[model samples]
Target: MTQISAGERDRADTLASRRDKFILPDGVIYLDGNSLGPVSHTAISRINHAVTHEWAAGLVRSWNSAGWMDLPITLGNRLAPLIGAPADTVIVTDTLTILIAKLLANALALRPDRHVIVTDSDNFHSDFYIADGVAAATRRDITVRRTTRAALAEALDDDVAVVLLTHVDYRTGELLDMADMSALVHAHGALMIWDLAHSTGAVPLHVHEHGADFAAGCGYKYLNGGPGAPAFAYVAPQWLDSLTNFLPGWLGHARPFDFEPTFEKAPGIRALVTSSPSVVGLSALAGALDVFEGISLDVLRRKSLALTDFFITEVEERLPGVFELVTPREHHRRASQVSWRHDEAYGIVQALIARGVIGDFRAPNIARFGFTPLYLSFRDVDVAVSHLVEVMHHREYDDPAFRQKNPVT
Candidate 1:
């Protein structure tokens, strides 16, 4: 195998300067951005301003004076371009689970005649749970249907009101063709909803371009928002007018301040807003979007593919037959992460974390690693693989302490 110079590749990287914007810990290589991204100077600074000035000084007046009420839509507009959504089409709001339930319920309203909601069997577990909850809320008027990704295309029937799927498989890091899948669902008169938690920031997304009826994603992952940060949702232009919020709040009222007795929903995506926004979380998320201001998803994707490809190539060359590659090798079919299946995957992940290389373990037998182009470099990837090589050959993961599983993993 030819020796690779990660230093040289990093030095030539145009996004190298973006790394300085983040505050990565010393001597640690972070490879779990898919779970939670590291903090950026911009996000920290923004959060501090919100605490010190907006909330502390302004108090109640801040709702109007500090523009606290508009963070959901305002911040969402900032996130719109990155996801290839039109202005005013996206709104930052509750957790992905809540958004899924709200969107799934609203889909039933759209297709009053339909009685089923179809989703992939491999979708994030929470998504399936939310869909079931939505179905149950209808007094069994609706049924939650599950199908494998390979079989999803043929599963839609007249009773299917919505088809919910994760754009990228959480455990395997496999990406699906958004345009083709969404189109297929529409042909059968069912709404399409996508959970983009894994691909929102690292992969190039075109929600509107792909004709998805609704899309939602988390901010804590590739967006670099802190933990429990607010999530975002997008509604297609055509649906913005006809859609109804399943969980409505005062803020979604046409005249929330009017204090009218009857419920009158606000126009456009604002109708999707439920309850008061998470001011601090939204503030941090808005701050995180600052990092992607002028950055192109296309450029980020190029670097991401390069990093993952390098890691895969090095692993195959050095440790043949050691682990089963779970992520797809094809660029178009891959997300911004990689995973490998091993009998001792949990131990390997713990061992890597003990050595300052942070990755996460998925249930059963998969070890996952995420790549964020905004703050990571070729050198980071190179070092992480080196640690894995040592951990495997030196049997560092054999320590009994690593066998104890944590609650969060």
Candidate 2:
């Protein structure tokens, strides 16, 4: 059913030569990098060394000798460049939920006189939930405003203490104008906190350049830091001097080991820490980041746009009536993914996976493909399109098993 030619196949085959760097399953077309990136060769080797040699052999000594104690800060410094943040502004720490709580709680502390915490309607659910909890904990009134950019711009008033938003929309892959939004928040005497879960690695970020007061993102998504990987939080350098964390555990204390009776928080980013770093996970993530050693995010962004655009074009031309594109077509307004809306989206996703094209399905009607340029190739994209065409034309997604809802989806 696919009209792809042998020349195109050969070109994709050549492009796949670099795929050896990833530990992907044979015959699988992994289009879920935006969810969880496949492990890299370097990550495996480094994790193995850390588990067998560094931790197993060195034990407690590894904290000081193997530099385990500083992995969070070190990894933060490494990730700073990728996210356009400066050193000491970012700290690799707990899950995104915790990080968001810390950032919001700290931001609220900065503006006790102001009562409102404004956020978009489409923010990731966890962010909204965390903000709700922070409001309850602080006994402060929270106002969530669901509005478009123009709406938000108009709604920005002096009463808003902090403006929260995700840089990229999870479902639609829509990118928000962080710089403009942050400027508007500051102009209204409010701080801005961003959720970067979908933006950090999918595209280039400039927190400092955008004048963001605080930000947080998941480690397992675009960062390719693996499942349950430690997330990161960024506090602007200027706020670092006054930022106060409510979750001040012993690990965050300035003299944690001094057997102090009271909690005296560590200075700067260290104050955000509430627990010891996850050593094994941090080690793996640290190793995985090395893959981007010579890679520029600009190049990554270019390739990402190309891959998503190619997918969109191929889908539109090859299966026009069968699939409906949900992601924005405009390049500047989109992220690194292309999503399609179909009544049988889940079933079609199952069929594609059965045939070895592995994308993901969102709720209701969205089938999502995350095109990670570091491991994806043009040929793989072609092959995926070929499989998709077959599944669509043959009506293979009509299978009952494909329709059954799974717990994970």
Q: What C-alpha RMSD separates each model from the true structure?
A: 1.1, 2.3
TM-scores, each model vs. reference: 0.98, 0.95
In model 2, which runs have C-alpha deviations exceeding 4 angstroms?
1-18
User: Which residue segments of model 1 deviate by more than 4 Å?
Assistant: 2-4
Task: Please write out the lDDT profile of model 2 over residues 1-409, one tens digit for every residue.
Answer: 3455435643654234446677889899999988898898888888998999888999998988998877878899999998899998889999999999989888888998888888888777888888888888997776666566568877778778888899988888888888988988899999999999998887999999988999999888877889999999998989998877799888788888896999898988888888888998998898788777777788778878877877888888888787888898998899998889999999999999999899889887999999887888877888899999999999999999888888876
Alpha carbon lDDT of residue 90, candidate 1?
92
Candidate 2: clashing residue pairs, number? 1
State the local distance difference test value for candidate 2: 0.85
Looking at model 1, residue 126 earns an lDDT score of 97
CA lDDT, every model vs. true structure: 0.90, 0.85
Residues 1-409 of candidate 1 have per-residue lDDT tens digits of: 4266788878878999998899999999999989999999999999999999999998989999989999999988999988899999999999888888888877788898889999898888899888888888885588888999889877988889899999999999999999999999999989999899998998989999998899999999999889999999999899989879878889999999999998889999999997998899998998888999888889999999989998888878788899999999999999999999999999999999999999999999999999888888888888888899999998877899999999999
Candidate 1: worst-modelled 10 consecutive residues by lDDT = 1-10
